[model samples]
Target: MHRPAVIALHYQNDILHPDGLIRVGLSEDDQKRTQLLVAAKKMLDGARAHGWPIIHVRVAYRHDYADLIQNAPILKSVANIGAVKEGSWGSDFYQALAPREDCFNEHVVTHKRINPFYDTQLCVLLRGLNIERVLIAGVATHSVVESTARHAVDCGFHVTVAADACASASSESHNHSLNSMRLIAEVSDVQSTLEALK
Candidate 1:
């Protein structure tokens, strides 16, 4: 069995925080939000225990929004609300799942697009680490999570999405994305993935 790199996408405050802007599909219920956090942390802890590489991905734009593509409404809103502005509180990772400073092996990938690899060093970093497979999980399972999974596959890396550890704008959205991803990647729960890491 090959060791897989864990790619955690868009767990930043701007997306998952209760006060954060992009709130439509994020877990609104207290119980549901807590469960998502716990599941995400569990997978990260499991990766750390096994010495697997963990990559935390975030999306942020410049103050002037010059770096933003200005193509989609969501992208436009980011600029309007000044969301995920670099060095802003909204850009920071959520407290619970933020990467530890002492963890030398933990990596961070900052991107402007939904796909973490685009115009980012994610692919080079994975290649340099000799990574062949990736375990992906993140907020809005229908967006960044699914987009990155598809990109990872095209990059020739075997992709697996940790289904339970991910959330979407709605349950239907999450399920639909997973079903679409199933054609190109393996979609499984976090526990099973951790066991596979062993």
Candidate 2:
């Protein structure tokens, strides 16, 4: 009955798209990027088909970067490159993954930090939807993707990561993060996640 919601993170131009300023933070290889987007689309489409609540999450900051927290090299790099500026093209979701305005079952969340739940309506939204288990995937497997998944587990919901739908700067880092997540969260492929959603 699609009890678990699906959270899609950082499918924005600044992270996932080929022209993104931070695309290298995920992967610069055409094969890896294509594989990620294709797998993510499959997961999203499968979830949507089963009527699962879908949350599209992205990281964006004001033009002046007032809301950004420069606490790390990568965090500071966001401002240096002027990436993901709120309402700018780079901050917009990738064309194919953008949620339709008319989709009532989907929501969009924009955060200023690597973790989407901090100071965001994510938890509240999940509670309102009566969701207790979540399926998640995103860019930079060791960063926002890992952060959000860990928090979801701490929040007491059962967590499952769609491994194939996530990407990172390198294979080693991505696998390392997944291994770390396995300690607290379930790690599964997109097909497995889709089957569960069904």
Candidate 3:
């Protein structure tokens, strides 16, 4: 059986759909569709009930755009077009899927890159816990989730993507991304994955 901590990737509150413009903030419907807040909740709930650890990998800068400007020029340029900024609602996790103080066992990384493992302490933390399998969930199915999944596999971690627990700007992109992930990792919905874990 797989013993793993659920690694919920960055659920940042920026608009990452349509034209990749931050000005296109998530509306009520977009939040429901893109963030998949309820799906994430179910996954977390299952993990909590099973007494499994939860690692939240949030993306936030240190109140400055310098890191992104220096390390990720692509992100910096997008910010120039009104993308999310540090310490803003657009930069924080979505309200529904906010990190829980009591249940949040690890904040493995505060990332600038799309992949949470890149230049972050994620691998160190996991290795310290002797964790080898990672159950991935959270926002922007194509970007953050897929990016981290790819890197996690590269780092020799067994990765499982919670399909319904993730979302992207579009269904087409989300489906394609999930399909690609299935080729490289375990891809399933919350129920199927939780059942397998147990």
Candidate 4:
């Protein structure tokens, strides 16, 4: 059986583009992503019930665009990329998923390329805590969750993708990534993961 673990949930902001595209950016109070908010709460509730640690990773860039340009060159070249940058409505953590004042011992905020651990201290933090199993739930299943799952597995962590705690830009993208994850990691629902913790 796997040992006790911490959870990683990616909270991000969404933007309504003039061309009818919803851009993924930094999460803030105003963004209020309904699906991700529900997922975050579910993760927290599950973790609390089992006394597990929960770590939140938020993605944000710099307002000057220097950060993305320096770290994620491909995304920088893409036109009208959506990412939470400082001093913008898109940069704040969505209030709905915001941790209560005392839920976490520490937190991580970063501007990463796809994976939260990339160029970020997330891996080191998990290592320091001796975490070998991770329950992941977050926005854009094909993006953050998928990216992290790959790296987590490579790093030797038993990874579980909470399906109910995640969503994508479209249903197709969601299913596609889930299928991909099944080959790399375990894919489960909120209840199943909760049961495992129990």
Going through the candidates in the order shown, the clash numbers are 1, 1, 0, 5
**Across residues 1-198, which tens digit of lDDT does each residue of candidate 4 receive?**
545465555553333221212344423342334545565677777776676766777666665656664445546533255556665566555555655567655455564467787788888888877788888877768888899889999999988888877777577888899999999888988777788767
Candidate 4, after superposition: displacement of residue 1 in Å?
A: 4.7
Task: State how far residue 155 of model 3 sits from its true place (Å).
Answer: 1.5
Per lDDT, the best of the predicted structures is 2
Each candidate: RMSD to true structure? Answer: 1.3, 1.4, 3.4, 4.5
Query: What TM-score fits each model?
Result: 0.95, 0.95, 0.84, 0.80
Please give the TM-score that candidate 3 achieves against the real structure.
0.84
Write model 3 residue lDDT over 74-112, tens digit each, in one string.
576555665556776666666666677776464546877
State the weakest 10-residue window (summed lDDT) of model 3: 16-25
How big is the positional error of residue 47 in model 3, measured in Å on the Cα after superposition? 1.2
lDDT of 1: 0.87
- CA lDDT scores, all candidates in order: 0.87, 0.89, 0.74, 0.67
Predicted structure 4: lDDT: 0.67
Which of candidates 2 and 4 is the stronger one according to TM-score? 2
The lDDT-based order of candidates, best leading, equals: 2, 1, 3, 4
Error (Å) of candidate 1 at residue 114 is 1.7
